[model samples]
Target: MIELITATQLDYFDNLYIEMKGDAVERDDYIVAETKRGFEMLRVVKSNYRVPKDNIVEPDGRFVRLATDEDVKAFDKNDGMARESLSFCKEAVVEEKLDMQLVNAKYTLDRKKLIFNFTADERVDFRNLVRILANRFKTRIELRQIGVRDEAKYLGGIGPCGRAHCCSTFLGDFVPVSIQMAKNQDLSLSPTKISGACGRLMCCLNYEDEYYEDAREQMPDVGQTIDTPDGRAVVIGMNILDLVVKVKYKDDYIREYHCDELNAVGEV
Candidate 1:
């Protein structure tokens, strides 16, 4: 099992895991560590999570030690520097007239690497910008282009649900959320209704999908012919939560029946 922590306090910071090396590290402990990208100083938000035995740690970055008062001071200083660097990068983007929206900036604990995140509708050539930043900051520069969903995840805000976004608060990574998940749950097909603040399909759509899938298998599809206790009927609608079906009889009489009360004779 490997332990890890988030590298920055930035609300825009995604899950940048820095693996904890020793047992001394605990939750909320500020520590210095090396990440795949570069050396980082991160606070341990989580600790002692199990990893599957079959899975090997990729590009293992080691935990150096818990942070001291001096270390905290240095971290704060680097944070201020990160903000300055972000401002610097934004100005450089304008000077170069690049088509990109800068998101956030981060600096390695050793101050040797500066990572910049941005989002663009299409591929952007920031090669000249990187050179300018490298020369200005006197460090390694990384320009990362992220998707819209990722941008929303990085910079979280109150969702339409009037709560914090799941991506920034709890989700470790994005799971595939398709339009079918919405259909399976009998949700409104309206994009605005189903799409999240990210302008992508809502992550919440996946939440009840498993139950809906199981319920769907048990319940007859709309317009399907079925033999009910009342009579042979055509399914008109469903109450997935109640495991019940609404059917229309040949006489045009409509009634609701429990799924178990009906036999799926055939499709109409």
Candidate 2:
């Protein structure tokens, strides 16, 4: 049977699923897994469950083993060192006068590589910064320039939705969000209302867009002249969810009618 395990780190947002052939593991158990960055300790977020091999794509990483006491110690040490490295890197950025905002840093579980994630408005020449970090840490250095969305993912916070940001909680990857999505849903064009903590269009805008788009196909646009049961009226507003349209007649009286009760005449 294929045993599926879900695991995550405190500092990172993405969950990693590991597949293995072994006894079931309990939630909160620490385990070693081979990831793209090498073997790292991850805490089990969900209990292991049996799944069909064909039901899932290849797992994110292979299970190495249950974490040993030594592994936990090493994980703790690495966490501390990674924080110190971030502090040092921030100082180096100031000293070098680099126009970049360092978000966080981490070391490979084996201490073979020190990785730094940063954000910048424009291209930043960080060759000297990398040299300085490599010399101080005495490890291979990787400086990654990430977008504003990624920065929010790394430093998580509650979104405007009054809950944790989706990208920092369960979203595996970001979907392309655009202003068109806001318009599709008939949402306010105000930036603050439609934008997320990252100052980009909220990811949730993409969730119900397909439904709105389909509904729009069956409805008349605002300002359109349509033949209502009463008479020809100018569409003034709409409640897309209920398929309701508000319109004004030649008498200047507005009335709500189901979209099904109206036929499109032409533009007002």
lDDT of each: 0.77, 0.78
Return the lDDT, model 1, position 13. Answer: 21
**TM-score for each prediction?**
0.83, 0.80
Candidate 2 lDDT, 65-110, residue by residue in tens: 7788998788789889999999999999999999999998877678
Query: What is the lDDT for 26 in model 1?
Result: 68
Q: Runs in model 2 with CA error above 4 Å?
A: 1-21, 25-30, 43-60, 68-70, 260-268
* lDDT tens per residue, model 1, 1-268: 3344453232112123333232455666776666676766666556556655585445346556667788778778988999999998899899999999998888777888889889998999888998899889898999999888888887888888899998877676688999999999888999999999889999988889999999899887898887887668899998888898998988999999877666443332
| TM-score of predicted structure 1 | 0.83
Count steric clashes of candidate 1.
0
Q: Assess candidate 2 and give its lDDT.
A: 0.78
**Worst 10-residue stretch by lDDT in candidate 1?**
7-16
